[model samples]
Target chain A: MKINNLFVWLKQKPRIAFFMCLPLILMVACLIIYPFFYSIFLATLNKAETKFVGLANFLFLFKRETFWLVVQQSIFFALVAVFFKALIGFIAAHSINELPSKGQRKWRGMLLIPWVIPPALSTLGWWWLFEPTYSALNWLLEKLSVDAIPWLSETFWARFSIILVNIWVGAPFFLIMYLAALKSIPEDLYEAASIDGANYWQKLFFITLPMMKNIISITILFSIIVTFANFDIVRVLTRGGPIDTTHLFATYAFRVGIESGDIPLGAAVSLFMFPVLAVLSFIILRNVRKRTNEV
Target chain B: MADVEIKDLHKIFDRTEAVRGIDLSIKDKEFVILVGPSGCGKSTVLRMIAGLEEVTEGDIYIGDKLVNDIPPKDRDIAMVFQSYALYPHMTVFENMSFGLRLRKFSKEDIKKRVEEAAKVLGISELLKRRPRQLSGGQRQRVAMGRAIVRNPKVFLFDEPLSNLDAKMRGQMRIEIKRVHQHLKTTTIYVTHDQVEAMTLADRVVVMKDGKIEQIGTPDEIYNFPRTGFVAGFIGSPAMNFIPGNIVKNKNGYSVFINKQISFYLDKEKEKKLEGLDGKDVLLGIRPEHINEKKSEDAIEYDVKIDLVEPLGMETMVYFTINKVQLCGRVSPENNLMSNNKATLNFNKNKFHIIDPKTDKVI
Candidate 1:
């Protein structure tokens, strides 16, 4: 006679693995999946939460000029910041790598200081640096006879200031990643290229770049995600000032959902980034998988 | 003019001297090998010649032009590294043609040179394969092919076969020798393997402690080593060294061992040891010099075989003399056994008497 016992079945090896994973699964369910679903529900609800207004909140967000502005600003901010971060990171990694190994260690430690500090804390320091009257950078520029220009109050300069701060915080991560990639290249390959009549630039093109193709793609992908959702730098530096020109998805959502108390509309606005992000992530991840498999 | 000339070359890293004042001139088509133990600066010397390393204090001339200030790119030399150093991303063809393409060789000329080198290396069919797709031996051949396509003024190899298995190493050794013969280009090879030095080089340079111990043809290095180090380092199973003395005897003088056996020094050997009588010296006995009583006039010793290794062609016999393990070679037909007494014949004329204080052979 067979007893269909659930407890006995749960004692099996596969079931034990599942049981070991139960805490993380339960945490994800309660903390992440539940909120996600609740946000979706909130996006479809009427203002009083008594009636369903499916797609109306979304339609409302789609029609707003400020919402579209946030979309453009978010993409532009992420792309420009990631690009400069990658460029600075590669150049820094190369110059540091060229130093003797002892110097390389010291410089690497110094460059990584910004990354080691918490983003919010570092953003606060940057806010002080970008302060309109007491700005150290403007003081230096004025000392050099340059005219004083608005950093946070202007439309263009505010976006530029936020991107610059984002780059300062994020470039070190790229520096570490690219340095690791550069070190992974065999020293002998460079020597061989030297004997084969390749100068520095030739070696960089034929040997270094090809070897680092995968790391560059992967780092850019990772930085894009982090920068696209970035809030600390923008909030500290500009707070979407100068006519809300620099409002990104995260800061705009905070303004609407938490600050202005339009919870359902804010949820709908926040969810607007999801589909684009999903498609971009899917494309890039597939490309990364294909490239890594090649290696 | 000589193809390569190094004058009182020296290289020091930090405080440690890697290559101390050394002078060597290589003929236009000669194949010279620098053989030494690791950290002895043989590879450092080769790298200096290739301009990969800066000479701490000396001049290196290539083709009558002082090349000390030239970068490696203009050194007109191609090097094969121990790791093969092929571009992993490039196909075999692209890897071989890279230098040509960089140098602005015509398309047809690059193709011809690459195909010819590939044919010479027996890798014609592997042109499209990437380095990761090739086996260790094929990768080695491709590396050599990459060098061969250039037909540079000099070829430098830094332990190119060190990464290969023993079988592949032997095969590549023969292939390298054949290529050297075919190309007749000036070549310099560096290795820690004495067998490679003995078998490959037109002349071998033995180094120790960052200085050249001796430079000679293979036969001279094997038969007439100038120092005790060279004598001991050049042979397999190593040259057995026994401490002894030359004492005056009724019939001229004899090398006296530990009451086991002594033979009168020949006139030639006696002349070589003129002032060393009654002085302590190291007697260099190669394993091949000691056999199973080959001649009646040879000094005979009843040595208790401590260990017997029966190689297919020879039997290696080991015994302790003054706490120094001495190795001797006998025919495998002798069928020697361990823990048994066997009389070994020491070739009296072949004794290399060394003044232990100077470490120099008489």
Candidate 2:
């Protein structure tokens, strides 16, 4: 009888529960769902100066000469940068994990300095190094009896510079994540594997990698999404320069919207990033769910 | 299949000597259990023998081959961990087959071996299921199955039944004994539970403070413990120790409890204490040896019953005599109750006497 009465009392407290959730519901409605639908509405319609032109902005984007070139370059940059970042990050994390606790902390702090430094400040220093004349790289090359090389002015050089900057800035995030994942594994598992006749390499392949599979998949998907939309480092270093060879979706949208003042076209270009982000997020969420199930 | 010998095995962990100069030998096909309380270094010794732990200043031999530098794999031993440590991602079949697969065994060989081990453990129907999907007892069988399939020369179990509930622990105990009987592998098990050690061990090596206190059969350890630590650690409800001096009374030598109760020494113990008259001694008695009702050859004592625990067939009566609280076993049919004044009797012939200073049997 008391249990039933308590249940009835809980049911009658809807007003209290509703008031408790009011702030949270309002925050979500105002911040997330509101802006989401608003962006879709804005993407569908043209700006003030131009009337509503359904799919015309998207068609114009496809017809543009620079769009295909920028798309190709962006794909190459994101893929190469993400691939190297994962490899180098995994290697660094493994090496750091092998060190003694104090040594690991020291090396980790030292390696993370690049990530802690402001990207704009670091890219400004990089800009000076890539200057056409009086550059430190050119000075080094001259000392080696080599001719001065064009680094940032040329299309390929700009692309390479942006990819290098992306790797430098992004690898540390993955290294930190992988290091945490490595430490989270129970030490007993390795001890057990060693007792079961596994050598160092066998332990690595069978235990370490399999244990880190979930972390690696989620981290890779996350890196791909972030690198695909990355703009700050590339914009500061290359400014989408050398015929827009370093332009990713983020910088391309910035150029079309702010630099070129083509609001409709810019919105369409930025909207192009939506499908990619959505697909990547879906993959990441699926991978996370799978990882939890594995645990 | 292997006789393991340890000579002066010492392990120092951060200035704490975990295993201090231990020397012992385990015969072939012998189920030797290293039993002790926590931090007694029994597990450390087992790991050292398995080659999983580095030996600081000793040599270990398995079947006449020096394994001081050999890896656990080269030592040809299989270990069942306390956690079971079954690969969560692998099915029971795969987990059992892993060791075989690592040795480059053929597909048919791995299948046959895994199937045979599963059959032995009665886990054949659950072979295809992952470890996380199985209950604790089933997982324990899978762990044992994993070890059995290896056909290793030596088998090591580190508190393998410590995680199970009491009933499950008893069940697994019987299962392990049955498996050991059939396989007859050279097994070394480490456990803090004396009951497991007593039931499972062919010879129990009682350890304390990183040293072997005594090594003997279960009966020897229970009937005669070399040290006070072993005496207190080896029995359920633990043997009670009453500190007093052995005085030459008119009747014979009696251990007087200072105006509370007096126990006359038996002939064998009295003979051993012939030269040590008037010396301080400790009277050790198991709970079962003390009864609430008097018998023909028992020394009577008036005890205040503080608590009564009815354990189905038998009841344990907790009481105090001479400010020392001790447990006495009584029949459940006696209807023992709490806070009741009672007269209990000690079986003086079965009592053990130890020198207080040396802690050795007098």
Candidate 3:
């Protein structure tokens, strides 16, 4: 394992380091670097690829109302969904960590089922649950003498259904991360806090939260990236429909490039996510590094 | 008057009994130590006194009040854990002042108390540093400082020095004793090291297999151990146990080991082995009790040396008596080496005679 450390090898042998880096360099050039530049090149061409229409696709997308809606909803959808996922995941991890080991295992397994199932398959089941006539939730509300609510047919409910499904598929990842972090904390800390006259809430705020801060930041950062470009839930459940209220960047790109047959426009729309992702990663990673250094 | 008393204490984890029927009454200002091997329930007893673990049966009293249901926070006790358990994110000042801050002490009061404890611990300059920045010894001092800052009625230390190196452990042992003398708070320290027990405790409670084997002053424990287990457990290099028989000789009754090794019973020793003539008994000989130089009122035996260990000031010479290995501490000036034929002198009065059947010192 020590032999696999790159920094050690780089410092010890220059020739071997260059030789080792060749495969990765070739991979980036052929698979990643080439594709990224080619996508940018494709974004510059017109729909039929017959004419160079520099800035036209960008100008057009900037002018469209649906493009603006997708932009607003993607940011909203990523932030709100990631926030709820993190909150629910933290609560579940904290609660399950308090249980006996056997019970904790049972609950952890059951909660992870949502994450383990394929997203498209699960989203299909969710779409059926949101059917206008046969939605099981609305049937329960109707039996309770409450008005049946529109799930997929209305814009608000459609966006709500998509965010709910996204959270369901992403929260288990956070639960596993936070739970491992919780277990890694020494039990002596809690015992010391007890002897130091700390109540439960005091221990939580003073000890647990501070110790888990780095893991919390890292998990949220990863969830933000994954949730921002989420596709399966919006595609399968709402089909980016209900007047495009639930159109995340991924689904919007799919509609413009693959479905609507405007490859250049779709490339530009998908390219829009890179800047936002890069900025969010920069901020969260900086905080994480600062916290780690302080520690 | 914050003495600690435990009556009929027991701690059972599932089917394994950790502490069984332990009764200890530590006087106010007394520094009592619980010493034992691993799995001896010494730490369990300490935790029950600190209220970190639930009392499976019976009662614990502090300051004359039964505290069976009291939480550790309300028990008015402070513990220095073995791992130190200093909060990594907080400065040493905050770590030491956490208890007082929890009780709503003013900032100035908290700062004064923390500074005082830090000065006592010689860690005043490390106040701004976090735990990760401190060395093992400094972290240990910070843990002690945290306990001292609380100024609780009782102080509990659970193997606090076991994590340090040998040199650091020795230094911290004296530091702990000095701290105990200064604070004069009723303190209960737990350690598996017999050296720590002997050096630190006003009285040591030796435990084994979830039960107390003996409780006495260090001198009493070392010299007049009532049980064979106590005799074997207290000393370094351990007490060598050799089984021999008492036989009536032409002069009087003597302990004989293959005719080459025998100790003539004096008047006092005769009285000790009265009515047990010709019966089997175990000789408990400490290494220091067996010396190479001759002395008054000691027995001499010639042995073929098996091993020699030079320890600067003294040499531990290993030999055998009738195929049973025995060790003797001698001055290293002789340069005794293995396979040498030497005469070892055994202090007749110093050796203990334990009855083979009862395993009790006679």
TM-score, chain A, per candidate? 0.92, 0.86, 0.88
- Candidate 3: residue A255 Cα off by (Å): 2.3
Q: How would you encode candidate 3's per-residue C-alpha lDDT over B218-307 as one tens digit per residue?
A: 999999988898899999999988888888867888887666667777776677777888898898989998887788867888888999
lDDT of candidate 3 over A1-295, digit per residue (tens): 7777865656767777788899999998999789788878888999997789998999999999999999999989989999999999999999999999989989999999999999999988988888897999898998999998899989998888888988899999999999999999999999999999999999999999999988898888888898998998888888898888889999999999999999999999988998988897998878878977875
**Candidate 1, which segments miss by more than 4 Å at Cα?**
A1-12, A283-295
Assess the local accuracy of residue B166 in candidate 3 as a C-alpha lDDT between 0 and 100: 98
- Which run of 10 residues does model 3 chain B get worst, by summed lDDT? B257-266
TM-score of 1: 0.95
The CAPRI class of candidate 1 is high
Q: Which number leads on TM-score?
A: 1
Candidates' C-alpha lDDT: 0.91, 0.86, 0.91
Which candidate model has the greater DockQ, 2 or 3? 3
- Clashing residue pairs in candidate 1 are none
Candidate 2 lDDT by residue in tens digits, A1-295: 9999877776767866987899999999999788666655555666553466788778878898788877887778778999999999999999999998979988899888778898878888888888887789899999999988788888877788878887988899889989998998777667777777888898888878887888888888899988898878878877788778778888888898778876666777877878988998999998878867866
> Model 2: which residue pairs collide?
none
> Given the true complex, what DockQ would model 3 score?
0.81
TM-score, candidate 1, first chain:
0.92
Q: What is the full ranking by TM-score, best candidate first?
A: 1, 3, 2
Per DockQ, the best of the predicted structures is 1
Q: i-RMS values of the candidates, in order?
A: 0.5, 1.2, 0.5
Query: Chain B TM-score of all predictions, in order?
Result: 0.97, 0.94, 0.95
Candidate 1 lDDT over residue span B1-362, tens digit each: 13899899999999999999988989999999999989999999999998889989999999989999999989889999999999999999999999989999999999999999999999999999999999999999999999999989999999999999999999999999999999998999999999999999999999998899999998999999999999989999999899899998678988887787677777766677778879998999899888886786677878889999998888999988788898999999888899999988888888888888988998
